[model samples]
Target chain A: MSVLVFAETTGGGIAETSLETVAFARGLDAEVDAVVVGELPHGAAGELAEHGVRTVHHATGDAFGAYSGAAWATAVQAAAGQSRVVLAPGTPRGLEVLAHLAARLDVAMAANVVSVVPDDELVVTRQVLGGSVLEEMQLPDTPALLAVAGHAVEAAPAPAPAVGTVRELTPEVAPADLVARVVSVEPVEAVDSSGLTTASVVVGAGRGAGGPDGFGAVSELAELLGGALGVSRVVTSLGWRPHHEQIGQTGSRISPDLYIPCGISGAIQHWAGCASSKTILAINTDPEAPMVTKATYAVIGDMHEIVPAINEELRRRRG
Target chain B: MTDVLVCIKRVPDVGGEVTLTADGQGVDARHVGFTVSEHENCAVELAVQVAAATGGRATVLTLGPAEAVEQLRSALAVGCDDAVLIEVCEPGSYGPADVAREIAAVVADRGDELVLLGNDAADTGDFQVGIRLAHLLGRPVVNGVRTVAVTDGVLVARGDGVDGVETYELPLPAVATVLEGGVEPRYPSLKGRMKAKKAPIDTRAPRSAPAGSGRVRLLLPPAQPSTVDVLGEGPQAAAAVVDLLERMGVAR
Candidate 1:
């Protein structure tokens, strides 16, 4: 009758993906209860309460400091006894913990679920074949475990309920559970974003950019339109860009309002990551490029010349 | 002396054309043959390389059906000193956690100083097994590992992150998930393959209690709608097609 979500946190705060999971659980029509396993940071509990979480269970221990699959699985198993469905984000920790919990509870678990609905059975739709395909699934059993894919759900801000409660559960773990400790935490520098996920415009590159130097022109065009820079797996493989900036199957997926792909052949894996963009413009010299077929607008010209011209036009329009 | 366990999976080649099953919950194995997964092979190779460098023995461990011995033979052919197949469950019956538990039980039974696995399996593309195994064993884990070298009483490794490669030095008995391009995986020679066929392989059921991971309803990808638009040949025709695309607002 209720949904128990394992809210993931880093540096004692809820992660953006966890909030997205919270938003998804609201659509399941189940009472949402969040389980936080460590010390709640200031105002963190308040944020969860605002999202219609009625109960927050805080399980505290030195064993819970770092991500321990067994410890988290034990906590989730204990929590699942009271809930109908247990949910977590399809992040590394989320998938790991849920995998263990599913085994411990002797229940089935589905990973990277895009959508779930209650019916005769728990009907779920998930991506398969590296996002090239969508598969619909039905899990009729009780206490179903599901890990929702990251970025698949949008975090919707909801008003806090009048009342919510927090309680603590002490997990039973051995000394070995404390063996793996996080010695330190380093935060990555945050970049100013026109919100890559929600941005109205995006510019993506691929191996066709030639290398890191080629990214200069793509970056310039992105800046002109106040958009974000994206790339294919090849760019990441070549080490020309960081993995976070890669916009393919193995990297951060985006669904911007307008997507402009330059000097890129649209592979199935890459298209799976960006197919959700509202409008697609492809600029490739290869007239038969796969991306050209998918694009709402196609420019059969040299990207080196076309991209710069577009950038100049946007700059002039801005000025 | 140090004990090393390398966990590997026998996965179908993902790059090949695949056929769907009649039920759509599994892959058709008729045309699909198994190979040591790209990353898992690297993990096994790394363990063998380290053992050869450090004067230790490398044991390859896997959990799958009886036919998975093909993968073990492949590992042994590559230079693994020994092999163990934990026949606890079939492939796809368990998720990463179940796999982690089985691996942990095997590790505990065998007593290993280090553990290694691929970053993700090729079939499911779930990259959490190595990390989860470490968490289950209560050991430190490093993901996306590139280079690994043994130091005095410790192991030093470099891993790729969201940013650049990160180097970490940890004591023995850590888990590492090998990444692509970490090292070129060596192919098994004819002599090595012959020796592997004669090699002794230890097979047993894992001792851990079963964790009932839920079942997933697997289905094949939808058929793509055919929209084959073959443009006419010649550069002039290509230019005309460009103009047509521009008129359609596809190109600017």
Candidate 2:
């Protein structure tokens, strides 16, 4: 049986995550095909060919102009005629559409899966509780529906490129399926700090920052370090930080090279988001806090005083 | 008047290391406290607000063990007018699909036009039930929503999409999985607590059989070996931190 992957697009090109997902599908030991909804992204066919995708199903029309989970699922379902296994990127839209597709097909789907071995029963390894735990799962039924987690596999080209023949289809979508279509889109608000998930270094603040006014030192440190600012769940819940900057289970998961969390009592939820970081330096007055104990480096002190000192030291070293 | 049904789950408040049970089927909850997830807290808050503004009934539901009544009562204390618990033998063992089916069976006839749930359960992180339930009930769904309100029979749900803040308007009989940070979940007052203590919980058994999601085991990730080097104490540690940063190639 063939494998079908939903190719998600961004900025007129295929998303990096979708390429990674295509690489993931190639490892499934099956002929890989792709389905792209909306306008076919530029250079998408050539890119899929390099990734060993044999067929590219392009589903586009007036009905596909807007983002509708149900309508998108219908297109994906229509395209997934012969493929028993379907995969999508573990992104918000990908997961949403897969959930809708799983329901429409009346099948069980696994989300954020890192590994899968197809057989009579599909064996999969998936991250749960925000990557802190790995669960080995089995899909008992046919047509194993899965959402591949972000960055689970490296994006690579095949040894030999495939034909990448493009096929077009007009999916019959009912008006009822477009019931939840997007009405409007408000542009993203400008934030002072860079994107947390894409940053190389992240400076995190938590309850130990004292209060909203206490973020001055840590904010300055983040700027001086040329890094983004991140905060723990409590910071957002307390309104000290915005939701986008919160690095925790209910927030963004980051995998930066260096992470310095100040005054954060590393709860499991918070750890789940930042655990993927390569190096962690925790600053907390309580040495026994989880953040301190689990960190590669720990400083036993108040962040209010320690952070500014670190900034001063950074400046001196730069001079 | 619109009726709002908020579904919640009782998850262990995992503050530290998550320990699995002897069977590896569930989390070892003996040491940790219990509470709903952050997203669920906001869902409960939104439900209470919608019910209050519309002069409608707000009901809390859960397909969990008998102890989940605690979560139900907590929602009641926060202004939910009613509670329903579909008691199960093992709540953790139920997959997202099974949970959705059970919920669909429970609320299908309740005439609840709006349903709210956490974007994903705190423990399982399935992120499937809300959308699945919507499809099962033939209602429209929107997940990862931060703000939602029903006005003149249309449910306006706004969420952070991949590109920007997405707004979706669905007709009555809809589902939304809420993410935290939109609204502040209020604390229960003394009077609300008293009423919740006396609230009547309608408990029942699940109608559908558990269709396993094929989960064989839950394994904690191998711990990263970390020996935290102490960088002195107070501001005295700053120089040492910068030195280390220099060594790590982060400091110029």
Candidate 3:
């Protein structure tokens, strides 16, 4: 069986989530072929090749310059003709394109999938009910479409023998498919913690921290420990933190070595995103908070006082 | 005149407490009941408001099982001039891309100059639908928009993000997803609801692609362990708490 994975891109480079999807596809041990749409940079295909992808299908067109669900779906459907399973990161683009492909192919789409196994039938596991539940479904049909949720798996180092064949594929789409145009593309300007993916220490906050101003203390503490700052869904919802900074069911899932959470109540949705952290330290005023019970170490105190002191202590230790 | 198409989704009510099963997958749907997603209703209201402002027409489209017609009628009750239901084989299973494609087909057929959708479906909380739909439509998309107004053939809109609120002015024939609290969603009046019941609805099967091989395994979340803590009342108690906190090294 061959597996075709849609490699996602942002600003002409492969997205981190797409790399994680590549890592997942490698585990399937199938003839893994990666389909990259749009204008890829010089070393893009080579980078994917390093991830155990044997073939790269590069689809390019004027319409492909921007993300069009219809156009991308057309390209992916065409690419999936040769593979048994089509996989993509459950990013917005991946889900949209895959959903269209599933409709075009008249098949079911399992989204936010955590696991996939090929046996007599393809079994997939996905989180449903807002991360409060999980569903195990069987896709009896061929060439099933799967969108793996972001951060479901860590991106593994590419194996040796970094050589892969690049095949050029162009999708023929209708005028309606080209209706949407990208007027402009701007990269979000914020602290890029690409290195934080491997960081040992992580400090996170929740709605209980208050708002954007509340994040100042968390950031200071994280900086003191040379760690990264993460937030819960409420922080994002309140516009105090970016969606990218959110660490909940619908946000970034992290598994840092030591995770410190301040004023976070640790709802199940939030826990699903960070339950994998090695050691968790929760500090909240509520002694009965879910986070207090779930953490490996719990400190019941006012976060306003506790967080600042922790930062002060770390600074003193460094001096 | 501006022609607008608003897309909506009917999902389970979000206010109720959710229970997970033993396998750590899938929610217990037995107690769950359906309602029009809150934000989607806002989208419909925003579209109706825009149409009222610009002297245009608003058409609502949805993809679901037969039961979804109730939501379409509800949209009509809220002031939508027309509604279309694109019947899907399985309602909740179809992802945003499928719905977007189907809606795109309907939009293409309906000849709408502008399209609007909720920022994200409350049930899935996947905020990519509008962007993806814009991508599929090959149109400019503004997401998380809290306010929108038309001025001299340009649509001025504002969206809230982590950094702050962003304002955009774009040409017509665009895709926008309405944010929560953008405007107060209107409830269906008795007269409007009765009129909606009498309105005709168009039903059809939107084009769909083949199924993907991925299977979803449903399981519930783990049971939450209980805990209890007692703190004495009154502002005079603050000093003792502070002292205890200092002893625990939580305060200076």
Candidate 4:
């Protein structure tokens, strides 16, 4: 079965998780193609080519005036005629569009799937109930829709590089397709490369960071380490940070080279986002905290003290 | 006149430890507790507040087993005018299509002027109900909404975006999926609880049969064996922490 991926774009190129999804489809031994909406950024096809994408379905239209789930799904469905399996990242938009497509096609769409294998039947494993349980199942229907679990897989170059072709397939969007359109889309904070998906280093804080004031030291440490600041869902619930900076199952999944989680109890929801990090360092006084046990390195101490001390020590080493 | 409808799900409380059932089809809830999923709780709360201000009626609905009435009663306690349960023999047996089809049928005949749902179900994490229902009803939909307000016959919904908060505007008779942190869900008061105990709940079976091939069985993910490397403890361990950070290339 051939694979079709709905590649999400950031700053005009492919999203990190979409690349990972493409890489994931290749692992299942299928030829991979991609569906891109809106303007094709420079070198877009070339970037996808390195990750095993053979045909880039570039779709652009005025009907896509805003982020309409139906319009995007219609575009994807138009290009999906040739593929047996369609993969989307486990983002809010991805899940919504896939749901719309599944309803339109009268099929089932699996969410947050971590692995897929093609035996006699396609076997898949997915994160369920906030990553606490894994559900394994056989693809019950052909031309199934599956969303790759965020950060669960890593992206790799194709075994043999093939210069792909860009196939423009624009669906004739009906007026009904533009039913849901955004009037104004603004960020609560300035967009940065230090976002969870793109950050090379993520310094995460949790409830044990005390109240909102406790985050000051953690932020200082994150700044000193040249890393992005991440927070557990509790921190956001407690109003310590905005929801955008949350890293967890319900939040943004981060796969950084190094993840420094301070005072955070590694709940299943939180771990689902950061487990893909290359290395994790836990800083907490409770040595028995779930994150401490899972970390590659553990510092059993009060982050209120350890964080500032680490910042000072960094200054000392740099000097 | 404005009428509000909120959809919620009864799920095992995520705060507790989770275990898989032996059959690998669902969670082992033998010892665990249940509660309204976080996001849906906020949605119900938001709908009640909207109905109160707009001089309209607020209704809460769910598709679950008979016991799901517990959640509907909680919604009633919080000032919703009516409650509904699309009774199911076993919950989580149907996929998103079936669930959305039932909800759409209800909306077409008897649902409210505006529909609100959690951004995604906390258990299944399937995010289709709001969008799919919107499509079937021929209305606009916006999911992942954190803040929603009504002004001049338009629904204004805002959600967290990569850069900042995103805002959407749509005419009346729209659908939106509320995010978890939009607002704190209110607790049921004693007086409200008494009313809830007497409140009548409307029960309906899913009108359409499961027509989709999306049935799934739950299983457990393979555990990663963890052995923590204790570098040191306390402020004196500062040097060790710095060394580890430098080794990871996060520090000099």
Candidate 3 per-residue lDDT over residues A1-319, each given as its tens digit: 8899999765656777898998888777787888988777777787788887888888888778665666787888777766878989976567767755765566656777787777877887766645655667777667877788766788875766447688898888777655443334334344244333455677889877876788777788677566788888677767787665777654557778777787888876677678778767777777777777767665677777767766665555446
Q: Score the docking of each candidate (DockQ).
A: 0.19, 0.71, 0.19, 0.65
How do the residues A145-226 of candidate 4 rate in per-residue lDDT, one tens digit apiece? 8998877787778888657789987689877667567767665444343666688888999998888888888888878877
Q: Judging by DockQ, tell me the better candidate of 2 and 4.
A: 2
Worst 10 residues of 4 chain A by lDDT: A187-196
- The residue-by-residue lDDT of candidate 4 on B1-252, one tens digit each, is 578889988888765367777776678777877777668888988898888878888899999889889989988997888998999887777776677778888888785878999888878776777777777787878888877777776888887664467787888889899887777778789998999999999999888667543445776566667788988999888999888877767784
Stretches of candidate 4 above 4 Å error? A119-121, A190-197, B208-216
**If the candidates were sorted by their TM-score against the true structure, best first, what order would they fall in?**
2, 4, 1, 3
Per-residue lDDT for B1-252 in model 1, tens only?
A: 666799988766444345666876666777767876556877888899888888889999898888899999999999999999987555766666678878988887777878988867766665667766776676766666766777775877775432234566667788887765567678799998999999998998866655533445566565544343434332223344434434544333
- The deviation in Å at residue B204 for candidate 4 is 2.3
- lDDT value for candidate 1? 0.72
- 1 or 2: which has the higher TM-score? 2
Question: What is candidate 2's lDDT per residue for B105-192, written digit by digit as tens?
Answer: 8878687989999998887777799999998898888888988988988899998877678899999889999998788999999999
- Which of the numbered candidates is closest to the native, going by highest lDDT? 2
Chain A only: list TM-scores of all candidates.
Answer: 0.83, 0.92, 0.84, 0.92
How does chain A of candidate 3 score by TM-score against the true chain A?
0.84
Which runs of model 2 end up more than 4 angstroms from their true locations?
Answer: A190-193, A286-288, A297-300, B227-234, B237-240, B243-252
Label model 4 with its docking quality class: medium
Worst 10 residues of 2 chain B by lDDT: B221-230
